[model samples]
Target: MSRYVALGSSMAAGPGIRPSAPGAPFGSGRSARNYAHLVAERLNLDLVDVTFSGATTAHVLHERQRSARPQIEALDGSEELVTITIGGNDVGYVPLLMAASLPAIARRLLAGRVRELFDRAARERALDDVADALRGVGTAVRGRAPQARVVFVDYLTLLPAEGAPAAPLSVEHADLGRFVCARLEDVTAAAAQATGCELVRAGHASRGHDGWSADPWAVAAGLPLPWRPAPFHPNAAGMRAVADLILEQVGKN
Candidate 1:
């Protein structure tokens, strides 16, 4: 079997998704059934999955996260495939959604702090930086594994395109979250185009499968029960969907 590598943040790691992947670093939260694992199994590839919960592009390309090395350190010219799902944490997308899910009194107390962390202008600047960083990641992967087929997998949609705000998130917060997600998707697409890597439009494919939808792919705000997936993160169904998408994309190439 050819080698395959998975890299990126929590969205790719599949935290709280039951049955952690073997050899996953402590606190990485990598799931055995995450999309990368699913794709690797379907394609019969030797998978090197280094995705981790809460990783940013900096961690993927350069910096260390938790006790693990930089994600790209797992890659080499022997790989046949690589998938990336990052940049959400860099712009505070889910973090802002989590803040918005806070209790009313807590929201009031933390509103200023949250805004300071996710101000619109600041997020815009960060998106630009994320775009550049994503390009850097693609370039680095090409240099290390020239034969690898790289795919940029964007985050799944968390809100409906047009609908009333879901529980635990006000209209304003929901709107802001949507805006951030859309911008992140755009940035990811642009980077993929610039880097000549394949793009899996997970965010676009997940439009009607928002957290509040009947067949939700993402988890809405809820209690942090051990059995439950992380709030605002992709669920099992979403991972399967994304794995299918990647399979289709790879098949075409």
Candidate 2:
């Protein structure tokens, strides 16, 4: 059987929104039916889920450097496959994006003084530091698993419902969100290229869908919870979608 490795944050961790029962597949927040598990099951491969809730690229690096256990340790020899989905929590921007509207936030940005808000938050929140850390991660992965096929997953665009009551977001906010994603894509792609890794455009899969839309792989509010243990994780359907993507990529490789 092929050995596969997965790395990233809450999305990878399966923090379901619904409450988790004891000994459940996933604890609280998202569900255990995240994309990784889905892919693993489809491939019938042994999977090492090296993901943590609220993990940042920097955190990934720090943990690898400090651990010796298989789950927490750095990659050793090259494997058949490896996937990473990180960087959302680096700046802690997801919460802001989810809570506020871009149009309302953009007004503040155009005021010239608003740039400070972004810069301050990026600096204080460790967003600005992610690029270098990601590069380092790429280098490390390559060094340890030189022959393994590495894949990096990107974030998707997030939009609120049409005319939904939401926190004010200025046009600038929306633009900035797009801008941030673009930069992230560029940086992550660069890292993947440098490490000989493939870039999996996970975000593209979410296009044309808002957070509230029924996502086979995503557990959001108002949806009937799937896993009894991990309510926020993906249901079986969601897992299938993720599995399909991975299987497709693996076949290509």
Using TM-score as the measure, which candidate wins?
Answer: 1
Per-candidate TM-score against the hidden true structure: 0.96, 0.70
Least accurate 10 contiguous residues by lDDT in model 2: 19-28
Measured with C-alpha atoms, the lDDT of residue 171 in candidate 2 is 49
At residue 81, candidate 1 shows an lDDT of 95
Residue range 172-206, candidate 1, lDDT tens digits: 77888888898999989998888878899999999
**Winning model by lDDT:** 1
Tens-digit lDDT track of model 2 for 1-253: 8787777766555554333313433322433456676677777877777666667776666643123222325466747778887777675455444433335455465654345445535534454577776777777776667778888876543543334422345444545555566667677778788777788765566544434455534433232334332222334454455556667887894
Query: What's the lDDT for residue 217 in model 2?
Result: 44
